[model samples]
Target: MSEPVDPAPRGGGVALCLPLDDEQRLDASARRHGVRVVARCSGASELAARIPALRPDAVVAAAQPQYLDAALVAACDEHGAKLVVVAITRDEQRLAAELGVIDTLAEPFEWDAQLEPAPGGPAPAAAADEPVAATPARGEVIAVWGPAGAPGRTSIAVALAAELAGRGGVVGLADADTHAAAIAPSLGLLDEAPGFAAACRLAGHDALTRDEFERVAEWVPLSRGGMSVLTGIGSASRWPELTAERVTATITAARAWVSTLVLDTAASLEHDEEISSDLHAPRRNAAALAAVRAADRVILVGAADAIGLTRLVRARLELLEHVPPERVIVVVNKVRASAIGVNPEAQVRQSLARFAGIDDPVLIPWDPRGFDAALLAGRPLGEAVPRSAARAALGALVDERILESAATRPGRRGFFTRERRLA
Candidate 1:
């Protein structure tokens, strides 16, 4: 159907996808360094279109939304061209870097350095053909995520963390929700410290060691069956500070600090740049995406009612686009017969299977009294109301899914796969 374009040889061909002024400024450099501007494109689609014909060795574009996205990065990768971003601001630079651009130039550019060969010259391109598998983490990072209707993510996360901590190992609950963060208030902890954000900041600076991580994560009292807790920004406006890079780095470093980590993430997963063009703004949903992507498994929660289940089905489709189906463990919260009619669990399961193609989902029954009591007591369901149906349900999930036999789990790792869920 489509014609095949032969791969462009490595040369001084650079495609420019910049603003008019920037194009004028860099135009002179084309003549000086024997660099040729093979094509001029506007956005990602146009750039991709030109790639087949021009066969550029590199693409130079401003770090604005119009010039950058996953599509643009993919085009460069497919065409064997280096995507070099022209960034002026720190946010722009971070955005470009996160987009997987290895080469970048600040505004008021240079062609001599750009055209210069490496000190040892280029190695054989065949060296890059090697394939590698990532090592499994020594510890487990569980992300408790749900849609915006509030399907009880914090409660599930706290209960799950408590269940893991009950095994007499280090555990942590991190509030990665940037919107309406209530982990501190839910657990009766002080909220002024900006715990997780501070950790992200330290992670951004490469200063978050295990000790620093523990220090930033406040420890609960033994009376409450202690586990380390990292609070979130109490206000939603502070989301930008939790950049994807920092959140990812913090999550990576967390493997050594705790045996299990539970993260309560925000509902939004939209990549902001996809919606609106900007001068390289940080994504509002970066923390949630980063946590979900970084986690060993994601606990996708949704309320049992019609609206919640509807949202859940939509979330499942979006989530599966990012992670494999095996990485997801669906949970229907507040499962009551009154909400979803005669057979709530069956209805929920049927809906999921029909709409989202999910066969098995963990169903936690409605237990308002137990949750209210636990909330008032400022403790997890496991500690405050051990006999709660919700607590028992989540406990069972943690036990069966997370605390499997040691033989299957083996040693602490950064990445691994046995039969795991596949078994």
Candidate 2:
């Protein structure tokens, strides 16, 4: 008889609470490295209760100010758990240190590298030579981005989320457009609720934990289709400390609870100097760029008309430098079939291919009636008009691409391996 195979020995388990959607992917990766993971409460009090019972070897709190608060750090230390904080900006780094967190990870991290132990930390043990379990990459992050001049970034983003939600798996839409605060009104989300602004506040405080985030995020249901919406900040001025670190944390936490994360970003790509100097320059909009870089895929929105197409071509060139070509998707919005001249799809494709060399752009048909009605009612397109052409197009994309691709990615790496620098 064949000998029985022994189970792989798992290293000490770690408890993770983060604000970013990518936390799920990261957690899966950590398990691949033979480490066990324990998901704690989304609130601080519950987390405090679970800590002693779980006796985690380490604690990873992403971009939540409360997690790094002096009291929490002291609690972790008292319990003999190492704490690692993932920050988005230099200020967060300083704040983390002040709170006694010595380890950190930045956003847009390479999955493998980010999971590695902090500098000077001991390396993780190797996994059993057995094949790693297949796990999906984090949910798809679709960005509806267009240049200034009403290219319909927000409209497309909202509609796309509605379509995806209609198809079922949990979905979340975030308004990360710092320049334009339209998500609340566009979706008719009540400003009285603690939405994106509250999350940002938690992120800035250095005392926020994953549990805290879950408490503050508001869930807007889609009556027509599928998914939920996490509203964005009401104004740019309110997010002075809205660093990339905080955004990553918030997304990570959201991912643990949701299946899809859709971000509506500002048109501009310029970064604020005061926010943090760590970001690379010439790519101005650090926050939006960070979102794009972290996303599994990006959907570029362009107007159907002539000038819109022109801006799309130009923006494509700029994006090429930051994201891979295969990952960048071009979308032409407000297309009209009857509006004379050459075929709208063919002409737009030909123009983009000729100028920007991009092929196969997704074209969303004109649906002014459906869109206007939904906007006025403060509901998703799926809820307002389930049969709209625009909604169908979005569904096709989500089913064929987003969900399928995420389901097939390689399983996460389990063993943590920190970088080894040679003298």
Candidate 3:
């Protein structure tokens, strides 16, 4: 059991999790230093859970490993609370740094200037809470985007990455799906600690370097070329960590290291930030927009049926507003005769050309068995089912579209023609 000690003098907040006598001493020392004792607890576990809710400007926890854990630091950082470990020994000071703690306060409860919190201490914030500059778009970045429906956005992205990697060039696959990331499971990646989230965290602190970015990337070997993946957040709730600035920085760093970069972005592109009108408020779709704006090319994926075609048309229009039509490659997935009652591929191509002005769009055949086998095996389509129709179509897409785009890299012009632009 822990005790709550909210003493007098409502001023800058200071949370304390120390022994009983130590708590009294620290409380008195804080008051002497003119700092308000906002919260006090006996156990570190209690403080860890309470820090975000309590919203103290600074926390002073004993240097013991139990009191100073990574979870406490993460919680404090998430809520904008600065954690200062109370270290009385050299080992404790080193431990604090090893645990990724921001700062450390020496024992004996001294009147240190760092202990004093700034005016208007932090308030309790809910747990849920950039565009690339024109500087030499380092490497060719391909962003994959689609509308609300599943539309096989991630599947297409994974297959595209595998194909790009098969070209024998260094490829970086980034799963930037903030809403619902499936790249880890889709590729059978057992990533308990996703690299994308870690990179984002480092980027937020301006500590992410090219080396660190590469270090976080997990290698996924392809048949021909080698590919590395920066998996998305562990869960959708952790999207706040993937800020627009961080996403851009991470992508830039990834480009610095890889020959080709493939980004799998979120489904929506609504400018929620405009509605909020607050820069601090987290925009859920910022990651998607940032990836699209920063990319050298964008892959627009949509399902093949009537409803899917309608959504794709509307989604394509919306996408065109942010991305130039020339750079967007339309892909229709799951094309089957049963769904459209005709030559599915031709119908999809005809509908896209007639309705969305997307001619020669790549149509992927529905191969449930092949897709399921690869998914269950946690391997790529090329490795799991090379004979799959969808795999063959994806390989064609790479050979015809991506490779050609790469060849004419400098000052590259988009593929959308004048008629399609007008239509």
Candidate 4:
């Protein structure tokens, strides 16, 4: 065996997201490390935005909660660049591994170390026999979607969030609908700051801290404590701001902010812009698409009427194109004999099963009065009319869905774990 000497990395180009002082230190240490700093930036978002132009061989980013996240890793992979993260804590190192980094280095970095191991990359994990680290759990995201016509997506999402909040840890309700945004007005929230859009912006900059997220979100009081609310945009024109990248970043930032997240999304699922328009243009439905894809469970709500049933059938077929059928929780709302003919529950069930191949759909009986009270009170039906049959139905639906998943879902250390105090 011959001893190899002068091990330079695959390429000299490397992107660095560090302070100016550290940037200078890296410049001084590059020669010893056998790598060149191609570009130096202060934020992961900035580093990502420059990847295409810089075309670096590797990215070295600070392992802060916001800066070195899934979005940044994804951005690097999309550009075919390896990531070498600088982590200071056991949790951050765990996060780096979970994100599949090519290399991990301790902060303050031993740059003078003989650049050991592989030709270009730094060493991997610590020496063997180090105790395994447990990563904290992230909140599960649930997206409530429906077809074009009003099928009560917002109503269901609001109630679901409230119900989840009452059960335990902090819950988040995000109004992610691009067209006809309504969570703010429905909840009597002032929408003065446009919570969700602001959060998206902060996430893009890798500045979405726990305090910042809480500041942007309005607290909605429920029967048991309350949930944080990220009101929808004041108008649909701002859809482009919620890009797929930013949406992904926001969801990652939110993992520690709450135990459960409920997103009320738009109806349209068309992403045909790539074929019809410029490939690089901002997508209008990117927010909804991102939410649906990121969700642990998607609740497809359908108004139990003749016309609504037709739309649901078509929408479910389209939704299946994006997510697996098992990942979706089919829900038929406002079920009543007057709208869907005799035995509305049976009719709705049979229609869904026959047309969409959907079995075991939850049918919530019509309780207009309960919903009306909630609307007037600027609250969820569960909080406004806890004893209503509709609320009870929603409770059972959530219990079944969450419990079923909990039985099989992989467990992680509790960062935001809440006591199971179901109301």
Query: Model 2 — TM-score against the truth?
Result: 0.60
Q: Write the per-residue lDDT of candidate 2 for residues 17-82, one digit (tens) a residue.
A: 665454566555754555455653343344555555555555566546644466556555556555
| Higher-ranked by TM-score: 2 or 4 | 4
RMSD of 3: 22.7
Number of backbone collisions per candidate: 10, 37, 0, 0
- Give one digit per residue, the lDDT tens place, for model 3 in 151-186: 888888888887765543456788899988888998
What lDDT would each prediction earn against the true structure? 0.72, 0.60, 0.71, 0.72
- Tens digits of per-residue lDDT, candidate 1, 68-165, equal 77776766666666566665553454455455442234333456433434335342221122211111235578999988898999988888887766
Each candidate's root-mean-square deviation in Å? 20.4, 13.8, 22.7, 16.2
In terms of TM-score, which candidate is stronger, 1 or 3? 1
Runs in model 4 lying further than 4 Å from the true structure: 1-136, 272-276, 405-423
- Residue 201, candidate 1: Cα error in Å is 0.5
Give, for candidate 3, the lowest lDDT window spanning 10 residues.
414-423
Output the lDDT of residue 74, model 2. 53
Model 1 worst lDDT window (10 residues): 414-423
Work out candidate 2's RMSD over C-alphas: 13.8
Sort by lDDT, top down from the best: 1, 4, 3, 2
